[model samples]
Target chain A: GIQVEQSPPDLILQEGANSTLRCNFSDSVNNLQWFHQNPWGQLINLFYIPSGTKQNGRLSATTVATERYSLLYISSSQTTDSGVYFCAVPKDGGSQGNLIFGKGTKLSVKP
Target chain B: SQTIHQWPATLVQPVGSPLSLECTVEGTSNPNLYWYRQAAGRGLQLLFYSVGIGQISSEVPQNLSASRPQDRQFILSSKKLLLSDSGFYLCAWRTGTITNYGYTFGSGTRLTVV
Candidate 1:
């Protein structure tokens, strides 16, 4: 079993502010993903980055697989961004889709 | 484009009552299906995963069970619900490929056992 930890368990930011969330895993992973659980409890996939950096509009993610850490950046945060951001690393194997999820970074974007 | 549909956005069941949650995926074949429970202050815990019909792998020992009667249909059931079973339950799906495509999660069902 691998351990995944997320930093800044809670965060409160003003709208238009920028923020960074970090995720650290105990072991090497072949599958790494970022998810946003909205206020309505819907889990939306943000990124699937096992390694390297990727940007999706105002949101970006960077995963340093060698260091077993990943960083998620949100620019110009908005009230709609207030929710739980989760980092998941699934077990690496053929036909194995068990994702080990972090407790998550609870972000509160105040308007 | 794949989509996952989970039923009953919210539920309030009596303790010791039976429980059944259903999840179905569209636009994919033989996709991997999973059931996860997110408790308060606790992260999402993998409860079950199935690679194919009637093939299920339990991740944790709990009062719940899962069944994959069809390739794209997954069901989570419990004979006797407990107060501890109250939480947000999510159903997700992933392709069989080992890389590239990301997983898709459903809207989730919030279960409250009274």
Candidate 2:
């Protein structure tokens, strides 16, 4: 089983500010994903980055598999972005589809 | 395009009462289904996952159980609920392969037990 840990369990930012969230895994992973859990409890998939970097609008993610870590960047944050951001990796690092999730980084964007 | 649906956006159940949560996936067949729970201010915990009909794998040991009676249906059930079971339960679906795609979660069901 791989251990996933997130940094800065709690964060607060002003609207239009930028923030970075990190996820560290204890072992190598074949699957890694970033998700945003909105206020209404809807988990939206942000990115699926096993390695390398990817960008989606104001949000982007980079995964360094060799270093066993990943970073999620949110630029020009908005009130709607106030929620919990979670990064997950496969429990077995295989094709089991069992995801091991981090505690998450709770972000609060004040307007 | 595939979509996942979960029932009863919220629920309040008495201790020792039975519980059943249903999740269905549309526009896809033979997809992998999963059940996860998140306690207050806690992270998502994987409870169960199914690769196909009647194939389920439990991740944690608890009073909770899951069943996949159909290709696209996953059910979470408890014979008797416990107060500790109160949390946000989410259902998710992914393709058979674990690579190249992210898992899509449902809106989630907030359950409060008294």
Candidate 3:
């Protein structure tokens, strides 16, 4: 089983500030995804980056597969972004769909 | 496009009562279904996954069980509930293939056992 650990278990920032979150995995992974869990308990897909980088609106993600780590970037954060951000990878590499999730980084954006 | 639906946005059950949560996927067939739980202030924990009808794999040993009676239906059931079972339960699904597809989660069911 692969272990996924996220950094800065808790984070707080002003509405206009920017921040970076990191996720480290113990083994190589073929699939990786980022999600934002809102206060209503909905998991919203943020990105699916097994390797390389992707950007969606004010948020972006970069996964360095060789290093077995991923980075999530938020620029000019909004108060609505307050929630838990989780990164998950396939429990077994390749076709296995079982995902191993990190504890997550709780972000609070104050207006 | 594919969509996942979960029932009973919220529930409150007695400790010894039974439990049943339903999840259904539409616009797709033979999709991989999963059940996950998140305790208060905790991360998502994989409880069960199914690749097809009548085929389920449990990731953790607990009082919970899952069943897939149809190609797009996944059910989570408990013969008797426990106070520790209180949490947010989510249902997710992805394409049934070996591609790099991401999962789509339902709105989740908030269950509180007393």
Candidate 4:
């Protein structure tokens, strides 16, 4: 089993501040994804960056697959972006998309 | 475009009560379905998944069981709920492919057992 660990189990920031979250995997992975679980318990897809860099609005992510690490950057965060950010890794055995999730980084952006 | 639907938004049940959560996917057939549980602010835990009708693989051994009666429908049921069974239940589906099948999660059901 692959263990995924996330940094800063809890976080609090001002509305205009920027922050970066990290995810580290214990083993090789075929895919890496980021998700945001809102206060209402809905899981929203953020990014699916197995490698390279991708940006969506004020949020961006970069995965260095060779180093088995991924970084998510939230720039000028907003109150609506406050949630539990999780990183999931897909096993490399075959085509099973079952994800091994990290405990997540709980972010709170105060307005 | 694929969409997943989960119902009841919220539920409260006695410790011994039976429970059933339904999830359905539209615009796709033979998709892979999964059930996950989140305890408070904890991470999502994989409970079960199905590749097709009547095919289920349990990721955790618990009082929970899942069934797929149709290609687009997946159900999670419990014979008797436990206080520990109280959590956020999420239903997700993705296309079964080697390339990539990004999962689309439902709004989730909040269950409380007392």
Candidate 5:
């Protein structure tokens, strides 16, 4: 079993602002993903970065496996970007790719 | 492309009642399926996951159990429900490969046991 911790726990931002969210895992992971749970509870896939960096629209994520930490960057934030951001890491080298999630950071972007 | 669906988007049942939640994956075969539950403002807890048909691995020994009858079908069942079982249940699936990626989660089911 691996432990994942997300920082801040909650965040508030104004439209056109930018913020960074962090996630740290206890051990190496084979797969890592960033998810955005909207106000309506739809889990939208943001990134699947096990390593390296990826960007989509105004959102970007980077995972430093050597450091066992990942970061999600939301630039020019909009009201629609307000929700819970989750980081999920899979068990290492296991037959099952079971993801252990961290208590997400709830973001509120006010217009 | 794979899509996971969980029935009864929202449910309310009394304690000691039978509970059954079904999940189905379309557009893929032999995909690994997982069942997770999240309490309010908490992380997703791994309840059960299946690598293949009839092979389920329980992560947390709770009142819930999971079954995989078909390659792309998963079910979570309980002989009797409990008040503590109330929460948000999510079903997800991914490809079964050495290099796995992010899973696609279902719309999620909000179950409230009174």
Candidate 6:
């Protein structure tokens, strides 16, 4: 079983501020993903980066598979971004396997 | 485009009541389905996953069970609920062979056992 730890368990930022969340995993992984769980409890897909770097609008994710960690960057945040961000990776070596999730980073963006 | 639908956005049940939560996927066939439970402000816990109809794998030992009667349908059931079962349950789906895309999650169901 792989263990995942997310840093800065809780965070609060003024609107328009930037922030970074980190996820560290205990084992090698072939599938890694970032998700945003909104206030209503819907897990929204943010990024699927098993390795390398990817950006989507104000959000970007970088995964250093060799180092066994990943980073998520939120640029110019907004109130709507107030929620829990989770990092998940497959327990096995491939995407077809089930995921082991980290507790997550709870973020609050204030206006 | 694929989508997942989960019913009964919220539920309140007695400790001994039976429970059933249904999830159905559309626009995709032979997709992988999963059930996850999350406690308040916590990460998700994988309960069950199905690769196809009638094939289910349980990740954790619990009173809850899952069934897939159709290619795109998944059901989570419990004979008698427990107070510990109170949490947010989510249904999600992803392409079995298309590994590049991340999973798509349903809106989720909030279950509270009194």
True contacts kept of 4: 0.56
lDDT of each: 0.91, 0.92, 0.92, 0.90, 0.88, 0.92
By TM-score, the better pick of 1 and 6 is 6
Error of 5 at A15 (Å): 0.8
Question: What is candidate 3's lDDT per residue for A23-59, written digit by digit as tens?
Answer: 9999988888999998778898888898999999999
DockQ of each: 0.84, 0.89, 0.82, 0.72, 0.76, 0.82
Q: What's candidate 3's DockQ score?
A: 0.82
Clashes of 5: 0
Per model, state how many residue pairs clash.
Answer: 0, 0, 0, 0, 0, 0
Model 4, span A1-111: residue lDDT tens: 888999989999999999999999988877888999888788888888889999999999999999999999999999999989999987555365788899999999999
TM-score list, all predictions:
0.96, 0.97, 0.96, 0.96, 0.95, 0.97
| Model 5 alpha-carbon drift over 4 Å, by segment | A92-94
lDDT of 2 by residue, A1-111 (tens): 689999989999999999999999999988898999988889988998999999999999999999999999999999999999999998875576788999999999999
- Give the alpha carbon lDDT tens digit for every residue of B1-114 in model 3: 788999989999999999999999999988988999999877899999998999999999999999999999999999999999999999999753477587899989999999
Write model 6 residue lDDT over A26-54, tens digit each, in one string.
Answer: 99988788999988788898988989999
| lDDT score for candidate 4 against the true structure | 0.90
* Tens digit per residue, CA lDDT, model 5, A1-111: 688999889999999999999999999876788999998787877888889999888889999999999999999999999999999887755557777789999999999
Per-residue C-alpha lDDT of model 2 across residues B1-114, encoded as one tens digit per residue: 778999989999999999999999999989988999999986899999998999999999999999999999999999999999999999998853545877889889999999
Model 1: per-residue lDDT, tens digit, B1-114? 667899989999999999999999998899988999999885999999998999999988999999998889999999999999999999999754677757788988999999
Model 3 spans > 4 angstroms off: none
Q: Which stretches of candidate 4 lie over 4 Å from their true place?
A: A92-94, B95-97
Give me the displacement of residue B82 in model 6, in angstroms: 1.0
Q: What C-alpha lDDT, on a 0 to 100 scale, does residue A3 get in candidate 1?
A: 90
Q: Identify the superior model by lDDT, candidate 4 or candidate 6.
A: 6
lDDT for each residue of candidate 6 in B27-107, tens digit (9 for 90 to 100): 998888999999876979999999889999998999999999999999999999999999999999975355686788999
